[model samples]
Target: MASPQPLNGATPKPKPITPSEISAEFSHHDPTIARINNGSFGCCPSTIIAAQQNHQLYFLEQPDNFYFNILKPSILKTRQIIKTLINADHVEEISIVDNATTAAAIVLQHTTWSFFSTLFQPGDAAIMLHYAYGAVKKSVQAYITRAGGHVIEVHLPFPLKSNSEIIVEFRKALQMGKANGRKIRLAVIDHITSMPSVIIPVKELVQMCRDEGVGRIFIDAAHAIGNVNIDVKDIGADFYTSNLHKWFFCPPSAAFLYCKMSDELSDLHHPVVSHEYGNGLAMESAWIGTRDYSPQLVVPEAMEFVSRFEGGIEGIMRRNHKKVVEMADMLAEAWGTELGTPPDMCSSMAMVGMPACLGIKSDADALKLRTHLRVCFGVEVPIYYRAPVEGEIDPITGYARISHQVYNTVEDYYRFREAVNKLVKDGVNCTLLPLCEGYAQLLQMLLKSSLPVLCISYCSAVDV
Candidate 1:
C-alpha cells in the first residue's frame, strides 16, 4: 500500500464558514466535507487558525526578537488565559508542553523518585487502570522497573453500573496493596479513559491516594480539557497534565503540565537536550531550544473563539454530551447491545459493547468497521477489542467507541446505526472480507482527494 500524501504544501484557498450555517448550540465552524475520526487531535475554529497564521508570519519576518522578548511573554499570557478557563488561582505553576504524553513523561522524569524508593523498595507497589493510555502505562512501567518498583494492575469492568461502583472497586484495590505491606508510591488516574470514554472520579481517587498516604498522583487528562470542566487545584493531585489539542481546539502540540507549589518539589527538567538544565523555570524547561512556538502562543485565541459561541465552552460540553448519549442509546437499540458506561460517566463520547453474536476476533474486524463506515456510510469512529488479563474473553464481544464533536450531527449517528445493522445481519466471515477489499479503494480515493495542492498543481492531471 502506498503512503497517503501530505496536506501541507500549496495551501487550499480559504473558505468561509458563516455563523448562521453552524449549529446554534455548538461552537465548531468548519465544512463537513470529510468525516472526522481524529477529534482526538482536535479541530481549531477559523479564528484560532487565523491567529496562528499571523503569529507564524510574524516569526518568519523576525525570528530573534520574537524568541527572546516576545515568545516567553506571549506564552505566559496564554497561560493566563488557561488559568481563567480552568479557574486556577495562579498561572505560575502551569508549564506548557506539546501534549499530555510529553507532560506525563516530564513529570515522571523530573520528580524525586528516591522518596518513592524508600517507601516501595525493590518489589513494592504502584497501581493503574487497565484502560490507561498505552504510552503512559509503558512510561510508568519503565520508570518503576528500573528503580526496582512493582506495578499493580487494576482491572476496570466494562458496562460499569455506576461511578460509586468504580470508586469502591478502586478503593478495594488500594486496600489490597496496603494489605501486602508494600508502600504505594503513586497512583496513575485517567481523567477520562480513551477507549471507553468514561470519566473517572479523579477528586475522589486523589483523596483516596492521600488517605492511603501514597507518594504522588499523576493524572492523564488527554480527553478531559474541552469535554468537561477541569480545575487542577480542585482535583488535588500532586501532578496533572492534559492536551489542549484533544478538546480545547488549540493547535497540535499545545498542552499544559501543572505541578503543585512546593519548595521540596522544585526539581523538573525539559524532555530534550537544552541549556536550562539547572535553572528551574525560564532557563531549563521553558527554552527547550527553538521550534514553532506559535501553537502555544495562540492558545488564548482558541479560548476566546470558543467563548464567543452561544453555549460557550460549558455550553459546547453540555450539547456534545447530550448528543453522544442520544446517539449511544440509538446505536445500542439498533445493535441489541448495552451502553458501556452510565450517563454521568459518559461525556461527549460513549462506547457500545458489541453483542456476543458479532464475531470481531482480529485487527481485520476492526479495520472492517473503520473502512465500511467511511466508504459506505461516510461515518468515522473507532472499533476494537479489549479484555482484562485475568478475565474471560468473549470471542464475539468487542466495542465501537463513538465520539461526538460539535461538527457531528444526529444524521451521522443514524447512518452509523444503519450500516452496523446491515453488517451484523449478514454473516461476519462472508461479509467482512469483501468490505475490507472495497475499503482499500475508498482509502485510495480519500488519499487522492487529500493530496497536497502543490502536487496537484505540478502534475496538472486534469484541472489545476
Candidate 2:
C-alpha cells in the first residue's frame, strides 16, 4: 500500500502505510493534537465527510427535488446497509434517528404510560445496569416515573472477573423484584459501557432477561456499531439503538433505532409526531420534519471506506481491538496498576486505572486533568469518575479511557503515556495552573523544571 501524499510538495509524505497507518488518511482532526478520544464523539474518515458534504450541497441546490424525490431512496439505502451490518431481521425494523439518545427517548416515550398501557404501568419495575449512561438513565427514569414505575439498578462489577458474575448479579435483582411483588417489565442494557469501556455480553444478558420474564429489553449500543460485530436479531433485544457518529464513522446526528418486527410493535411511532408520520415503523421515522439528512445518506460510503482498508471491516475491528489492548497494557504497566478490564472483555476501547498519587477528588478535578493533558500536553483522552453507584467505594476517583479507532497509531498512545508520566511524577497543581504564560518564561521554566518535559514552542503576547 503506497502512503497517501498531500497533493502539494510542502507536506512530505511517509511511504505508503499499511492498514495500521490508516490514521494518516483522515484530515479532519487537528494535526497538532493526539486525539485518543474517538469513543466519546467519533472522528469521521475523510472520504465519508466528503460524501456528506456533497450530499448537503446537492440538497441545497434543489430543496424540493432533493427532499421529495431523492431523500427517501437515499435513506432507504442507508437503512438497508445498516440492517445488514447489524444482522437485523428486516430493513423496516430500523429507523434513522439523530442519535442513540433520541432513539432511546423515542422507545421510552412510546412504551411508557404515555403510549402503551399494557407494558409499563404504575409500580412496574424497569431494570438497568448501574453502569448505564447517565443520560439514558435519566430518560428511563423520566418516563418510568411518569408512568408511576421505579428503576431497578443491577450492580455489575467494574473489575469484572467473569461474565457469569454479571448474570449472578442480574439474577439477584430479578429475585428481589419478584419477592417485592413488583413486575420487572423492561431492561435497558449496554453493548459497551461508556465510562469503563467494558464490552458487555449483550447476547447472554438478553437471554437472561428473557428467562427472568422481563417483558422487553432495550440495548444501548452507542459504542458498538463500528467497534464490535453486531448481531441484533441474534441478541434478541426488543429495542436497540446505536450512533453512527461514534463508531459508524458518519457525521453528527447520524444514528438508528431498531425494534423487533412483530405484532408487539406494530403501532409504535417516532417520538416526533409530525405530519409525515405513517403507520409503519420505518415510514414514521423517515420524515421527522426538515433537517440535515446528509449524514444518513452517507452510511454506505462510511462502511465502504472502512471496509476498503487493507483487511476490510473485520480487519479494521481486529486491528483496533488489538491496539487498544496494547495501549492499555503499556499504560497500566507505566502506572503500576492493572488494566481495569480483561483483554477478552474489551473491544476497541479500554479503561486503565489512574495512578493514586494524583489525588483527584471531584468531577471538576477529572475535567482539569483532561484539560491539562489537552492544553499542556496536546493529548486528548477521557478521564472519568469510575466510582460505582453501588457496592464498595473505590479509593481513587476514576479511570482514563482510551479509544482506539482506525485513524490512530501507537505513536498517539505514546504521547499520552509521556503526558501521564509527567503528571504523576511532577504533580502539577491543577487548581492554580497558569494558562498562557509568556513564551520565553515558559521556555525557561520548562528547562529549569526537575521533570523532563516535551516542550512545544509557540509565541504570543498579552496586552500590557
Candidate 3:
C-alpha cells in the first residue's frame, strides 16, 4: 500500500517521535543495552515476534497442515506484499531466500553452471566495488573464478567527494576490463555498503553498465529495504537482492531476490535442489531444507507495522535519516572527529569517526574497543576500521557506524558518548582493553550498579 512518492526527493519535517511512542511499537527491545547497530541485525517489533511465534506454534502442532497449506501460500503472499515495496513488475519475478548471501549464491551458481549460453565465458571478468560485502565477494570468486573468469574492482574513494566520482570510477573499471581483452560479463553493485555504510547510486550505475555493454547486473542491497525508498523496475538491473532482517524488521533471516524476466534467466534455479527442481525460482526456493519459515511468513505483519507510522514506510525512513544525521553530528563534535559520509549519502546509518585517542590502528583494535563497550557500558554498536584505500595516503582510522531505528532515543548516543569519555579519562586504550573476564565482569557489575567511583578505583588498582 505504498504511495507514489519520489524515492530520493526531499521530505518535509517528520513529526517528532517520543520514547514512549517507540515503546508502544517496539517495546520488545531490551531497554538495558544501548542498541545503535540496527544496520547489522535488526530488532523485531513485539507484534511481529508474536505473530512469528504463532506461525511457529502452528507448524509444530501440525506439520502436514502447516507445510501443505500455510507454507506455500504464505510465502507467495509475502512475495506479493514485497513486490509493491520494490515496484517489481510481477510477483513471479521475486523469490524469498534466507538472506542476501544465499540470494547471491543462487544467482552466481546459475550464471556459472556449465550449461547452454553461460554468462561467464573463458577470460571474462565481473566488475565489483571495493566496498562489496566480503561474503558476496567470495561467492563471486567461487563461482566466477571456477568458470575461468576474473574480478575487476572499482576503487571508489572513501569519504566520497561526490557521486560523480563514483560514476567515473565505475567507468574506469569497465574500461580496464575491456582494455585487458576481457568481456565484462557481470557487474555487482551494492545498493548500500556494509562496514563504512554509504548509499550507492544504483540507478545511474545500472544504466552505466548498459552503456558499457556489461552482460548482467546484480544489486546487493542487504541494507536497502526499509531504510530507502526503492523503485527496482526503474533501476533496471538483471537481478537485485535485499535482506528483510537488516532494515525491514523481519525476524532473523528473510530476503527477496528479484530477477528480471529474460531468456538468460531460463536456467536459473535455487542453489538447493528439492522436489521442485525444474520449477521456477519461487517454487524451487520454497522448500530449502525445511527450515523455520517464521521470518518469511511474517512479511505481511511487518509491512503492516511500518504502515502504522505517520508517512507509512517513507515517513519512518525520513524520521530515521534525520535522527542518524543529528546524532552523527553530535558525536563528531563531542569527540572532535569528522563524519565519514555526508547526510545526503546516508539512509538510517552513518559513519561517525571515533576519537583518535582510542588508538585504534587495525580492525582488531576496533573489535576490542567494541567488546569493552559491550561488556562494561552495556552499549552495542559497530566500529569499523578502514586503512587507506588504493591511492589515498591517509592513516588507518576507526569509524563508529551508528544506526537509528524506531526504538532508539537521544539517550542511547549520550550513553555511548559518556562511556567513551569515561574510558578516555580512565586511560584505557583500544589495543589495551581489559582482557580478563573476571575483571570485566567486576567492572560491569559496578557500572550497572551506578557506582562509578568503585569502578574507577577498580580500574586504577587493576594491573593488566
TM-score of each: 0.83, 0.86, 0.89
In the range 140-241, model 3's lDDT, one tens digit per residue, is: 988888778788888877777568989999998899988856788889999999978889999999999999888889999999999998898999999999
Candidate 1, 1-464: lDDT as tens digits: 96555577564432433455454323443333234344456776666777888989888888887877788788888777777766666676677888888877776664336635463476667788878888989987877767777787777777678888778888888987777577887788999998767899999999988998987788888888889899887999877788887778777878887777776346666777587666664235457887787888887777666666566788889978898888888888877778888888987888887665556666666666566555544567787665434566553356778887766767777766766666565544422344446445745465458553321211212111
**Residue pairs with backbone atoms closer than 3 Å in model 3 (clashes):** none
Q: For candidate 2, lDDT tens digit of each residue in 245-302?
A: 9877888978999899988676677788877666676777778888888988898888
Which regions of candidate 1 are displaced past 4 Å? 1-39, 111-120, 281-283, 362-364, 388-396, 430-464
Clashes of each: 2, 2, 0
lDDT for residue 301 in candidate 3, whole number 0-100: 90
Candidate number achieving the greatest TM-score relative to the actual structure: 3
**Candidate order by decreasing lDDT:** 3, 2, 1
lDDT of each: 0.71, 0.79, 0.84
Superposed Cα deviation of residue 417, candidate 2 (Å): 1.2
Q: Report how far off residue 167 is in candidate 1 (Å).
A: 1.7
lDDT of 2: 0.79
> Residue 129, candidate 1: how far off, in angstroms?
1.1
**Model 1: clashing residue pairs?**
276-283, 276-284
